[model samples]
Target: MSLRCLIVDDSARFLEAARTLLERDGVPVVGVASSGAEALSRAAELVPDVVLVDLDLDGESGLDVAAELARCVSSVIILISTHSLEDFQELVAASPARGFVHKSALSARAIRGVLGENGTGSAP
Candidate 1:
């Protein structure tokens, strides 16, 4: 079955890029949000299989959203961010998110791998 996904990012360009990539790979993007609050509200409605969230949201932190999402839904949370691991260690320690993805290195194949798709890898 095709995986359902939700993307939460503040950047319009990044959201568009991620949407294009997921659509091309046959993953259905159920929703998109520009902030943590929006993502939280949408998650309850969308009930996606996976949630790709940006750590730095417009108002609140995405880590906060991920933690709340874990409780609200069964979706696997994967944080996408430009921050270093060291910078986000506290948030990572507090959340139940499944993985962390760097925005600078994000690609369709890598995203596919995160979604448990076969034949996709971290390297492009």
Candidate 2:
């Protein structure tokens, strides 16, 4: 089955581009959110198979958001960032998120790699 996806980012531009790219790459984007509250609400309502959360929100911490989602939602949370993975390596390792994907490299294949590394399988 195709994995349903939810993308959470504060940038409208990134959100649009990401949704388009993921959809084109055969990942069904079920929803998008710009903030922690909106992300929580959407996740609850959508119950997606995976969620890509930005590392830095406008006023919220993406790590915190990921933690909450990991606790409440059954979805595999993968943190995405414009920053280098080495810069946030420790933090990402400590986070409840299944893995990290740089925004520049965001793709269905990359996401599946993360899931596979976490033993979550490649598809839902």
Candidate 3:
């Protein structure tokens, strides 16, 4: 089955662009939230298969949100950021996120790589 996704980010432009890009690449974006509160609420409602969360959600911490999601939901959480992975490697490793994805490298293939897919299936 295609992976259902929920994107949590503070930037409206990034959210839209990501939604468009992922959908174009065959990953169905189930929902989007601009804040941790909204993300939690939407996640509860959507029950997506995966969630791409911004490492920095404006004044909020995406790591905190990811942890909360991990505790409350069954979805795979991935942290996304414009910053370099090296900058947040330790923190990313400590967080509940499955992995980190650079915003510039965000794609179905990249996501599939994180999920350890061998490209034998359709979804990431």
Candidate 4:
């Protein structure tokens, strides 16, 4: 089955662009949220297979959101950011998220790799 995805980013442009790119790349995007509140609301409804949350969400903390999401859902969480991974490597490793994906490196393959899928099937 195609993985259901939810995108959480404060940038309207990134949300739209990411949605388009991910859909075209065969990721089944279920919802988009522009803020932490909207993300939580949508997550309750979508229950997506994966969630791509930007590491920086305006004034709010994405790590905080990640921790809350892990408690609230069964989906795998992957953190994304325009900043370098070296900047937040330790925090990302400590968070409940499965992994970190640079915004520039966001792709279906990268996401699946995190989930241990090789396109044929999920990892054993």
Highest TM-score among the candidates is held by which one? 3
Off by over 4 Å in 1: 115-124
**Residue pairs that clash (backbone atoms under 3 angstroms), model 2:** none
Candidate 2 — worst ten consecutive residues by lDDT sum?
115-124
- Per-residue CA lDDT of model 3 for 68-110, tens digit only, reads 9999899999999999999999999999888999999999888
lDDT for 27 in candidate 2 is: 90
Clashing pairs in 3: none
lDDT by residue for model 2 (1-124), tens: 3479999999999999999999998899999999999999999999999999999999899999999999889999999999999999999999999899999999888898887843244454
lDDT of 2: 0.93
Candidates' TM-scores?
0.81, 0.92, 0.95, 0.93
lDDT of 3 at 18: 100
- How close to the true structure is residue 68 of candidate 3, measured as C-alpha lDDT? 93
lDDT, candidate 4, 1-124, per-residue tens:
3689999999999999899988998998999987888888899899999999999998888998888889988888999999999999999999999999999888888898888878756564
Error at 12, model 1, angstroms: 1.5
Ranked candidates, highest lDDT first: 3, 2, 4, 1
Sorted by TM-score, highest first, which candidate order results? 3, 4, 2, 1
What's the lDDT of the predicted structure labeled candidate 1?
0.81
lDDT of each: 0.81, 0.93, 0.93, 0.90
User: Which 10-residue window in model 4 sums to the lowest lDDT?
Assistant: 115-124
Tell me the deviation in Å of residue 35 in model 1: 1.8
Q: How displaced is residue 120 in candidate 1, in Å?
A: 6.8
